[model samples]
Target chain A: MSVQSKPRVRVPATAAKGELIEIKTLISHEMESGQRKDSAGKAIPRKIINKFTAAFDGKVVFEADWQPAISVNPYQSFFYKAQKSGAFTFKWKDDDGSEYTAESKLTVT
Target chain B: MPNWFGIRTATATRRQALTAGAAGALAVLLPRMVLADEAAVADALKKLYGGKAMAEGRIKLDVPPIAENGLVVPIGVEVESPMTEADYVKAVHVFADGNPLPGVVSYRFTPDCGKAAAATRMRLAQTQNVVCVAEMSNGTLFTAKSNVKVTIGGCGG
Candidate 1:
């Protein structure tokens, strides 16, 4: 079943050239590990965001491999140096072959 | 009167002795369990870095000293780097000593990323150390660690 997923991204609106800046991201997901049993004792199928990636200016800046142990509503923050004005694309890959994406722009002075 | 079979007397004393012995064993084993978790962390590190020595600096690991819930412990890691094409952080790995799986997550970064830092939420099995190792493009490894006391277990406890 397709679920509604939302991704949030935060990036500095502006930064000095060559200055290090932080980027934070959070995504809403159930992150079910399939280990839980339903009220009727049926096993719940595992559905989690297994991979995440961040790309800037067509180059991959960061990537993460996630497991079922990641908590619900996964939050991730990372840093990148400001080289020039560009857009960062964040993508999350779910186990069910669904992908959620978000974007943030950074302007360097 | 003495019983014909010695089984009656042996059973009575043996049962009592076994109970005492079991209790004593448990008392000794409980503390060792914590140490075993540390060994697990060490083993995971060895598997990842092999014989390469990791310098313990340049990386900042932010984790709460006391986590109210183990299910969702916030973690942040950042490494000092120029982020230039010549010298940048290539990857970062996070580990939990008390979890069933020692390796929690691994992040890779390119020079275009500009900085070497990541924050995420992790599920800790119990009170344990959260360790981070950052790999630089120059083949240098930096390490940092923080202890988190988890009140409630997060790994399906």
Candidate 2:
């Protein structure tokens, strides 16, 4: 990918057991919707993140299938119940089959 | 053709049934002005439901009433559910009525997520309706729709 896209995730360090906590994630990607034309009026091929998943302790909690309409540098957020202290793995897969992964630790009280 | 003695002939009943079946399909397949404009959105919805009735509730769509710029519009969807193993939101699909393509995003949820809510940013080509549908674990579907007015184009060259 020409753009240096990086995944950023936000999670609290600690949460009460069974607490419903909101998790936020964002990645900087130059999403090409393929609807735009270049200065020469040629159609640009599509290039964007196609899938995203959030897993707690290796089990997926939430997943998203993205389309070309997603904005550039997409921002996504969801809710997760803090049951046990475990690492949350976030993955974003691109059209070129490249995957970007990030991790955050949640300490359940 | 046999002459029927009933109030309506067999051909009449058959024609009515065929018309009813084709009505929904026509609404999805018939393109207005451009190919796959808003008709694409209807097609997606029909493909997901597969002729099943979708109830109009239990889904909350949060989108701006007016978008100053169409390049970045925020959208959020939350479905009313217990989020338990027995009953939870299975998936949520979003569509834009005025985009080149109807598909915006789709999310799959599990009980471990605790809540059935997701937020994301999208690009809108113009003012249009944002459609959302949530599938429950028990195979029930719920839907909601909201409109947004955009000032500037998002996906235009």
Candidate 3:
């Protein structure tokens, strides 16, 4: 199975210069706990997205590390004050070494 | 004969009912209780604000005190910030401290964000602590927390 499904990211279309803007992101995932048992009662090996990062204009804005227990389709919402109009990149990575990325741009008016 | 009678009476009375009730409730709630133990927000909190003292403040967290749906609950946190380059808001981190992974998400920021705020929807395993931590550029951390009561559990409920 693919490690992760596509992620969705959204940011406001316009913001006042120097306004703190909100960013939202979500990933489609099945964060399986290793402790789960299959139909045959065998333990289901853990599969999880272990890390996430948000970068704005090549500078890191937010980053996180997740454990096996995180739920499927993890959602995150956060804020960054707009310094200048640029793109924000969001990345999600799994324990098996796979990565997915999404980006959103903000316009300062 | 006396010992046998006492044992039989005990099994037929209050002790038996209490034992049965506790066991039944536990059996029904055990899976949910364990599943509800995950908190991604709490994990994120420690990672970002490790070794920093967090204090309660006027920072407002806009969220339903009671969430009807456990899967997606809307939440917002706004803190008062000067928004200056020397002492502006640095980063905002939100956590569902009691969920399976306590550390749910982290947002780093700068003075450019005129104010300190964030809003998003997240899956909560159960009723838990939704904590907001704001790190200032001056290396200080401010915090606010609220308890959200969830009727139906969201963690695979």
Top candidate on TM-score is 2
Per-prediction DockQ comes to 0.53, 0.65, 0.25
- Give the whole-model CA lDDT for all candidates, comma-separated: 0.83, 0.91, 0.71
- DockQ-wise, the better of 1 and 2 is 2
lDDT, candidate 2, A14-109, per-residue tens: 999999999999999999988777889788899999999999999999999999989999999999999999999999999988999999999998
Clashing pairs in 1: A80-B113, A80-B115, A81-B114, A81-B115
**B1-157, model 2: which lDDT tens digit per residue?**
2345454676689989999989977677445324245678878988888867889999999999999989999999999999999999999999998888899999999999999999999999888989998999999999899999999868666
Question: What TM value does the first chain of each candidate achieve?
Answer: 0.94, 0.97, 0.91
Candidate 2's error at B105, in angstroms?
Answer: 0.3
Q: Across residues B1-157, which tens digit of lDDT does each residue of candidate 3 receive?
A: 9999998898789788998999999798666444323244444555666656877784788879998876667777677877666777766666776565555555555554556666556667677877777777777788888899988766552
Give one digit per residue, the lDDT tens place, for model 3 in A5-90.
Answer: 78988789788876666777888888775645667867777787777888879887666555543456777666777767888888
Question: Which of 1 and 3 is ahead in TM-score?
Answer: 1
The TM-score measured for candidate 1 stands at: 0.78
* Per-model C-alpha RMSD: 7.8, 15.1, 7.0
Ranking by lDDT: 2, 1, 3
What range of 10 consecutive residues in model 1 chain B has the weakest lDDT sum? B29-38
